[model samples]
Target: MTTRDPAARLLRLLSLLQSRTDWPGPELAGRLGVSTRTIRSDIERLRNLGYPVAATPGTAGGHRLGSGARLPPLLLDDEEAVAVAIGLRTAAAQAVGGIEETSLRALTKLEQVLPARLRPRVAALAASTVPLPGNGPAVDGDVLTALAVACRDRRRVRFDYHDHKGNATLRDVEPHRLVSTGQRWYLVAWDIDRNDWRMFRIDRLRPRTPMGPSFPGRSLPPGEAIDFVTKGVASTLEPCRTVATVHAPVTAVSERVPPVARVEHLDDQRCLLHIGAAAPLTLAVYLAALGLPFTVDGPPALLEALRRMSQHCAGAVSPATPAMSASQPRADAW
Candidate 1:
């Protein structure tokens, strides 16, 4: 047998233990090409650092991973490695709202350890992905940091929140969580002003420089704070709202309608939908696509606008209709 670096040999043994389900002493000795005596010493070396490798005495059983004093390094298969690589790429793109720089830093660390062959695979995948930002507002880095700190410390924040009509009012709210939907970042908190949970767009925030003192967090909100924030922010725009009586159940409408629209139950098999849009025609068209009967109550202007739009569209033909054949010259006429 060849004599190899004992330390390197031991580390190799540990990697095999972590990777395999079970190994008998003979099998392990055969793989390492070392005597069983050497395997015991190597096992001891792993145990010293908190790995708990258990040896079973039966022919059916061999050596397997037992709970360790502390967790050991993960030995990922090819698929898991690729999944992790893709996740890192996503985070680095900053689709996560406030964690862009931090995600990039973590990504650099991940790239450093990648096996040489896998590194190129990750790079090729990353090259193909691109991000397209939408019309949603972006938050200030400082506000993100400040809110994060407040959430971590269990603090209350007091600030002047500007309403949709651009009315500024003083508020004191218990900071809860920050949520990020693709187009926006939101801070969901118990609005001290309204005494209700409200989701504020991060871009809209002008937090009072020193956030108020720390307080115990409320029972963490029902689901993710982001979802609630998305809902709350959406509900705020109801001034030029459309109140509709739709044939569909509230549940059905809620499921079909986008988060941008609002609906409430009028009764079973029926729902009241309230939606607001900057463009009345656009909103009207979306509701019309539901293919159900609906009655509307709204500003006369919007109702008239929808009426005109309906007339314009009712006479319209499907876009898929092919255009008339291009004109052709006749040789006989020439």
Candidate 2:
């Protein structure tokens, strides 16, 4: 004779119930490797959790989960549910290219099912979310779903990608993961065409059909998928990369910067930056606007350009004495 722990046995019963539509008392006992008596007790625990489990007796009898009149006990606590609702609502605003509509639909359903006590908190959080402007083009939500599926199912994806310079190329990749980096999303995968790993910003992709075939997956390299994409997108992939010596501590400007931009501290008052932007002039203007003094490091042209712009913004760039500063506080003051 064997005796199984009650709670563990109860969880096993729930797992059995979730796996199929119906199971006879004997069948459940056999699967759990427990006795018929234990199976009956496990059913009690599930019922306590609000699962609408029903049983019929005799040879035709079995255990089945029925539709309940109310929501079952969920795994998440109040704070967790509120966070999920807020995140989904935020996603709906992103209406990312392919999935906005679906996100809105899912969010609507989740919000509808919220319990009376949690409703206000979820509602308030959803109402207060404000989405900022996004870069990267509109990405189709369907693409996200498809990529996600491929990752989960260990399948392959084929798509046409448009590069930074607007060059189109066909690709076949084994999608290992999806990475959302602020305004944009990316996929990290093993590229079939190049025979190497690569990262793609989802908006820049146009998936090709008949999709692609699943392949044997390999372990992903160190680092999170999103960080890998962040480094790729914010680094040298753009038209140009610029490094500037900003005369400010890294901490002072870290929060005000984008993830694509990198900063290294220079003593207590200066930091070096590695940043990418579409145009050299645009890059120069951005650094000049940082409100901190900086020395342009390279691409001699950019240095000369920054100097010229500095002269253009001479009055704007200079600090006025505290008295003169306020009549017109320096736009660069902050």
Candidate 3:
């Protein structure tokens, strides 16, 4: 059986090749419902159109799509086209520094070719959504690319890193993984000199030339890379830290706090929360906002801050109303 419309058949053939790494001539013919001879002609037609479709010889030979000097038009289904459009729009607004403009350019080109049916859906989404401009420092595109390549190939990289106090030091590490938390990028790696795992902010490091030899991959620290980076970043950035006993279960407390805060279960009904902020007042406000029953021990400053907050709340109430009930343990209960 052969397709009556040659153009439609060629599109189906292209889609099939793009979907997988290899396809035997007979298999391609069977799937397309065409003769092997017709498959050969279709393959030639695709090649003539600048698609780098590579063919192999011999009984076990097959065809595969290989990288070419230029990119050809891609075949995307309705859902795929919309997804790409939305992704590009998001990247344009919040991606690492240099790619924003490039993303917009690509989006414009895609919109031009998008089927008329999808235009309004994409437009409505773009119009209704707004991305907050990221205030975090921008990462250099070249440095990002170099680190990505090193991680992919399991190679060692040396870089100059600046700590929070502005002290500069040289670092040599085995690349492990890159983690992004919407606002910043972090590299989780094994520090050769420290003999331990370390997380480095991508924006704060400058990659040195001549990458070191390939390395054997090491197991990442206990949890997911994102969690490791989050905990490390919070500890490094905030000077004041404390642990509190939250009356709610771990699952309940986890939902209210940022991922940077660590939550551990103590029992079925109680959990521990490890959190930090620049000052005791800030921490007080954060706990108060939780609206959960919790208790904090000394870090005398935090206790005093909570006492002050309690007074403030008491003072705000009217004398006519009964004294604020204190039977329950709350953030300001002290």
Candidate 4:
């Protein structure tokens, strides 16, 4: 019948509340071995410390944690803690923009508090895994965070954007989501000026201040964010349309062509490649490297480049003198 210490009891109460939603006053008091009045006091104390605890109405009223501005200390079991630590380490190496430092800081703090038994496993995983370098440009971490917050809050944002051609313009949009493509990040937003959805590369965005007033969340454009953003990006690349009849199946040729390229099956052994590149020469080299026979049509320049390259390659392997049979060579200074 002795009461638990105030700090320990409070922590225990918080853990119990976090474990589930809707704990009736009597049930909570019974679990804590305290009076219903004490349970109510503890709920108030949790609220004072920035936890949003809501009370349900009716004869069986209970307390539940609601959304709040500030985050409360999380109650994670041993395995959950390890999973989070590993995820943080992965993010620290792979996250786009300036989030690497922030992730590393979080990871360090998590490792510091991890139980000694779990430390070595986490450390071993961290040491053994090697991250490959990403080719995409680094985006500003603050810009990404701000846009994400605005998306969650259904707020409008304005930013200075430079298009693929390096044209600068100011844009106002209602952000719906931040899509990460492993190498890059994209913002899928409803462009206010254009009256349509548009995708912006996070690295090229220079978000302006005052984020704009809150707006109602808008339904995303008629497809998955990944598909929309990828198609949008393909449309902006340098125009180098080259069509060729490749002597390969559509499946085989497609594996070599850029994802944006269109392929049409002419038959089982031949397919048409409609790809865009910066120039004909670049496209020709790309096709040639696929090791498939292809015939280029249109843009006579591509055919000429291919011919020249073919001759050049032939010359490299050709010998300066014709081959001779053994014993046909003369003595050096006879």
Which candidate ranks first by TM-score, i.e. highest? 3
lDDT per residue (tens digit) for residues 1-334 in model 3: 5666999999889898988999999999998898989999999998898888999988999999888888866889999999999999988876586888989999999999999999999999999998878777878878988999999999999999998789999999999999887778899999999999899999999999999999998987536787898889888876677899999888888888865788989999999999988899888877877788999995989999999998998898888987547885555322
lDDT of 2 by residue, 47-127 (tens): 887788999989989999887877653445577778888778777667376466777887888778888999988777657
Models ranked on lDDT:
3, 4, 2, 1
lDDT of 4 at 262: 69
Candidate 2's C-alpha runs over 4 A off are 1-75, 108-120, 123-128, 162-168, 204-228, 234-237, 247-249, 265-270, 316-334
- For all candidates in order, the CA lDDT equals 0.74, 0.76, 0.88, 0.81
Ranking by TM-score: 3, 4, 2, 1
Candidate 2 yields a Cα-based lDDT of 0.76
Candidate achieving higher lDDT, 2 or 3: 3
Worst 10 residues of 3 by lDDT: 325-334
Off by over 4 Å in 3: 56-61, 221-223, 249-252, 265-270, 317-334
Residue pairs in steric clash, candidate 4? none
What is the per-residue lDDT of model 4 for residues 85-154, given as tens digits with 9 covering 90 to 100?
Answer: 9888778776466778888998988887889999888889889988877787888888888999999898
TM-score of each: 0.57, 0.65, 0.86, 0.66
Q: What does candidate 4 score on TM?
A: 0.66
Q: Give the candidate number with the greatest lDDT.
A: 3
RMSD of 3: 4.7
Q: State the displacement of the C-alpha of residue 287, model 2, in Å, after optimal TM-score superposition.
A: 1.6
